[model samples]
Target: MNSALVRVPGTGEVSLAPADTPEPADPIAPLAAPWVGLGLSTPDGTTLARKVEKEGTEHWQQLTPARYIYKSQELTVASVFQETKGEVLSAYFGGMKFAAVGTSTPKVYRAEISSIPKGDVRALCVDWIDTVSDTEVYHHRLYLPRAEVSETEDAQWGRSQEARWGMKFSALAPPKGKTYIAVWLTDDPAVLFGAPAVTTGALDVITEDQPRGK
Candidate 1:
């Protein structure tokens, strides 16, 4: 017993501890924008997409319930993005035919994308992922949803900019429900996928593995 040795309790396997092992990275290390990306949960509930932008969610209330006044409030999740197209986008937006002469109702549009045909009310979720670290991610799931789209194109005839769309959605809690927004944060991808944990190390456990800032 001259030297320190570690052994498994049940198997009785003795192992030597290495002195040169590097320290684990900081799990709560700060992150930056260049290596971050946004993802939206797909319709099939199987995967994610990079269609979403870094634009954050907006939550506000005009009056506090404690104050007891006529107050206006809305809990909404919005995604601003340059116009893009795909099966997911087409299905979600209801056939991808953007026109000013539309007479259909919002309920009709939502039904087109919703896997569950809950007319007038839908459910959606978004994922905020860190590309630099590939470790941490934020997932937001909302209930009882409604969607609105606003797009603008600036035509100066000289200066040009790409048209952008703002997807405004409001979510509400259902009856007997106390939660409106559920957020999940984790460094492991398997956890996000609802699978068992199976990874480790500085990249997985600690640091985001990003470059330093100026």
Candidate 2:
């Protein structure tokens, strides 16, 4: 669960942040940008997608164009760990991602934390990916003022991955490219999905030979 503020691939900057909460002071503002792109990696040329916990009761939500999706419980990163369950949703649009975070919200851009240095918010930002090989080679450097950044004509694919992660990350799909992979939960946001982890390796232990839904 090693986490670090990735410098957006091109600009060497980051302009990301967690969503703010009610009372304008709840802190841990993931409530604002509840969904984030965490890490993008090169596929081992294994299965297309794999289910992490398909049968887990934590899996809920049964509506089209889901506002929120749930997953197995989440664990904390503190020396003393606590397990907590939470809603795992992937919004279809950018500003819309924070649409359901609170009652009264701030402008979409302000809601973004730009970086998660501390607190109980968990999100992943997959700003860049090499779709040709299904690998993450670059990310959006948020440090550069968004206004000062150049517009990317090809940044319309991460959303497809986000949607895949919400319901079918483990499912096999046609060969693809540039993936911004991430695992997140609100409660103990510092563990696997939030902040940086002591070790940079991920715990992907599923054996490839096993059937898709074994």
Candidate 3:
């Protein structure tokens, strides 16, 4: 197993935990912060030996949970406007391209922040709104981060939501839970195809601290 220590940027550093160390109370806390976007092309199961190409990393975190929170914040902001990095937000795995903003609970330029850090640990973990439709604009599937909401909501054009992982809707391509967030919308397919998308981009590297998509 690949093991190493990653430091938190803004927050104070914590000792590196053993490989797959179980920290039941750190979902909302930044533990294993990921280095900015570092691209690596590695085969499956050989993630430990993956390389790093140093691409533009939109988000960073100390541990896996922290990474999610940080990325979510950035994604939340990106949804409101198209000006974050101005990187021409590409579609994630043939999905929509959204402008990003903010560094906390961010969203695509087209969408608003739906997910939020849950759990009593402050930053131990984060989840999306159950419905993805705005509570105010029920038509758009505000941020309801649970399975029950997605199962019963009336999905509309260019909008979809899932409350739990492994329970994605057929119309939407987003995976369940906190896994790969395959985008749901974008203006150009070619541009979306330019790179592998945000989640994939993060997984491209083996030593990226993130092991999910590797």
Candidate 4:
């Protein structure tokens, strides 16, 4: 069996930025400022879910439905954040205000969750890395131009376990011509299987043979 065909997120990271921040053009380029990492997450990692709703049109004279009408589509990413830092708290409790105060040895941080706003949209990205060796690695990324926290799980404080913030972000439609979500992959299986490489706005599949940092 070819190990290259198998994919595992050896290391995963979740980052967020302002909704208008430009999506990364280079598949493997390192993320820059404005993109703040949410820090470590639970071992369960992240979950990407897509749900499609459709309605079947039925005719009284026909045995089967005439057609299936597309009703709606929803894309969501859920994860349990292990860190309770300012970034994580701010994200989990949307519309909350976070601040760092004092000149003491360890700066005191606070997150005030007074209200939940209607549309707390943000640009979000999740990166997965699979390292085969020091020089050979595979990267996968999922990006959403506009997303909001749609649901959150209860945060429990216990002496036996660490506190975790669990939340789900629902992808929103971007500006008129922009895609709601984008995905990129390096060392793609399509290229390994000898399929022609095709580049489009919504998805990108890169091979090792291609020039880097394009």
Candidate 5:
């Protein structure tokens, strides 16, 4: 059996409570602070951005809950235009377009990013870090196999802000298998993929402070 043991930082006390203990009154409050990392990659998960772009640097911005909604056993991802410059914007647009159209066709680099006519729906993996703590970090990963770019609204140009790009992606369930949401609480981000997507066995690895993913 796999297990994860959590101990309080700078103290000898273990973090686990008895099985009969009641749950927290407000569970959502614990996950109030979140950090999101968005990346651009091929349908097969290979990153498209060159190393010179400082690939892993994530932009900290407001993610409207109204845009990204999760309910009724479905997860929909969307976002409004936010001011960003350079490669970061490029990567984001790439991911959005890639999700909209499959990569089998060519992409046009004109003023407006457009792809060749094709019906290949690629995949987009959004890695979400919900909570970081002294002992471990909680992660929720969404793998959208049927992701596609939806319609966009016009943006008003003003001196106070630069034109921003709006993105919308729908994550439909694959023909077989369960939904593409994975949850894990671990000290290492690499092990998050091993955690279960559904509620069952979600915390099975809670005691595994140091785990190696296969």
Candidate 6:
């Protein structure tokens, strides 16, 4: 087995955007305007969790369950953001709005906790980069078109450690013609048909250059 396939994410990023923001077509593309970055996460980084609950059907004659019935599934991404900025605060507590007051050098930014409605949703993206060298780098991206803040850890305010906002965003079902979540990567030989890297060129040229027949 090739050991180069082993991945250890050296760095990562988490960002949030308006729910209506269009999903990125390219997995490794840089995020543009209207996307707010939640900076400086803890060393633990981010966790992507998927939970599935199912019911087993029992039969009197059989000791083990005969079959399992599908129930529900949940997908969540949790992270502790070290930044105490307005964007991080707003993301940690849903329905909280961040506003900047005063037009001076020392402007007061406020994020007030308010009644969170049921439909408060946002678009979330998580990125992981594994860099073996300057020329060899792999990028992984997870995108959720519709997601909501489902859980939050306590924010401690003390001198011992930095104030961190830890929260979990749960993916929601997309509209009739949309997707709930998407995970994509770049420069992974296991998934990219042994291609060490992705080539950015014209589609026609790429197809013609391929060894496989058209």
- Tens digits of per-residue lDDT for model 2 on 1-214? 1223333223111112343211112222322343333322223211122234333233356434433344543221111001111222211112223333435556332234335333223222212222222343322211111111111112223544422221112111112452223222222333233343343356433333434555
Model 3 lDDT on a 0 to 1 scale: 0.22
Candidate 6, pairs of clashing residues: none
The deviation in Å at residue 78 for candidate 1 is 2.3
- lDDT (tens digit, per residue) of candidate 5 on 22-106: 2222212232112223322222322112111112323347433323332345444555535443333433454322233445457
lDDT of 6 by residue, 133-181 (tens): 8987888878888789999899999999999999999988887776556
Badly placed stretches (over 4 Å) of model 4 are: 1-3, 100-109, 185-214
* Residue range 1-214, candidate 1, lDDT tens digits: 1011111112110001111112113223332222112233222322212132233334375433333333344455554444343323432353343333446655233223444433233334333333323442332222122322222223232346544333444433333433333233335344333333223443332223434456
Local distance difference test, candidate 1: 0.31
| Model 4 Cα shift for residue 163 (angstroms) | 1.2
For candidate 6, the TM-score is: 0.80
Please give the clash total of every predicted structure, in order: 0, 40, 60, 0, 6, 0
Question: What is the lDDT for 85 in model 3?
Answer: 24
Clashing pairs in 4: none
Query: Mind sharing the TM-score for model 3?
Result: 0.14
Q: Choose 1 or 3, whichever is better by lDDT.
A: 1
| Model 3 misplaced regions, further than 4 Å | 1-25, 35-83, 86-214
Better of 1 and 5 by TM-score: 5
What TM-score, over all chains together, does every model reach? 0.31, 0.16, 0.14, 0.80, 0.35, 0.80
Model 2 alpha-carbon drift over 4 Å, by segment: 1-16, 20-51, 54-119, 131-214
- Scored against the true structure, residue 176 in model 2 reaches a CA lDDT of 42
lDDT of 3 by residue, 67-119 (tens): 22222211221111112221111111112235566665745346432355221
